[model samples]
Target: MTVALMWEARAVAGRGGELLAWARARELPRVPLRRETFRAPQDRVLVITWWDAPYDADLPELPEPDPELVTRAVHRWRFEAVDGD
Candidate 1:
């Protein structure tokens, strides 16, 4: 089985690039991670990370959180490839 974990967070001003670099560096070895950006008219920014990993299998733990760059907002999910396709 495969699962997709979606994370939505708000990034600090002038820090999104730094955060992205950090995330790309830390993403798991075999997992697939992708990001998308959205800009609000008021200048706020939203970043979403879509991470895919095998389901019902142990996943590598993530590193310690960075306190300065990202603030986690919502985490919602739907199961995929539930029977391992």
Candidate 2:
């Protein structure tokens, strides 16, 4: 099975660009099958990592950035791909 890990964080007030850069520069624990980064309207940054592993496997994920840069705690989610190419 394939696991998709999603990480999201909203930067404080006007620090979106800095936060995004930080996220972009940060490295993941391991190289994923695929990775993607996104920016949202509310100064939100989202990173999605796809891994090839068992459904119940525990994978290393990116740690949250400095608290001062974000409005609140980072959000993370895991999903299993139902279909794929």
Candidate 3:
């Protein structure tokens, strides 16, 4: 099975770049099959990591950024592929 973990965060008023850089510099204990990072208008950063594991398997995920860097706690979601192909 394959699972994708989504981590999203909204930086403080003017710390978007720093937050983005911080996210980019983080290293997971193990690398995933695929990973991607994205940014949005409201200084929001999103990182998705794909892994080959069961839905409930233990997987590496990005951690929360420094409290001073974000407006609130980070948001995370886990998803598994549902296609029948």
Q: Sort the candidates on lDDT, descending order.
A: 3, 2, 1
For candidate 2, what is the lDDT?
Answer: 0.90
Off by over 4 Å in 1: 27-54, 73-78, 82-85
Candidate 3: minimum summed lDDT over ten consecutive residues — where?
A: 76-85
Per-prediction TM-score, please? Answer: 0.48, 0.94, 0.95
lDDT of each residue in 1-85, candidate 3, tens digit only: 8899999999998788988999999999999999999988789999999898999998989998989999999999999988841
TM-score of 1: 0.48
Tens digit of per-residue lDDT, candidate 1, span 1-85? 4555544444566676665555546656554555554554322344444446556545443343466665553334434554543
What are the per-model C-alpha RMSD values against the true structure? Answer: 5.2, 0.9, 1.3
Backbone clashes under 3 angstroms, per model: 0, 0, 0
- Cα lDDT tens digits, model 2, 1-85, are 8999999999998899998899889887789999899999889999999999987798878788898999999999999999973
Screening candidate 2 with a backbone cut-off below 3 angstroms (N, C-alpha, C), the clashing residue pairs are none
Following a full C-alpha superposition, what root-mean-square deviation does model 1 have from the true structure?
5.2
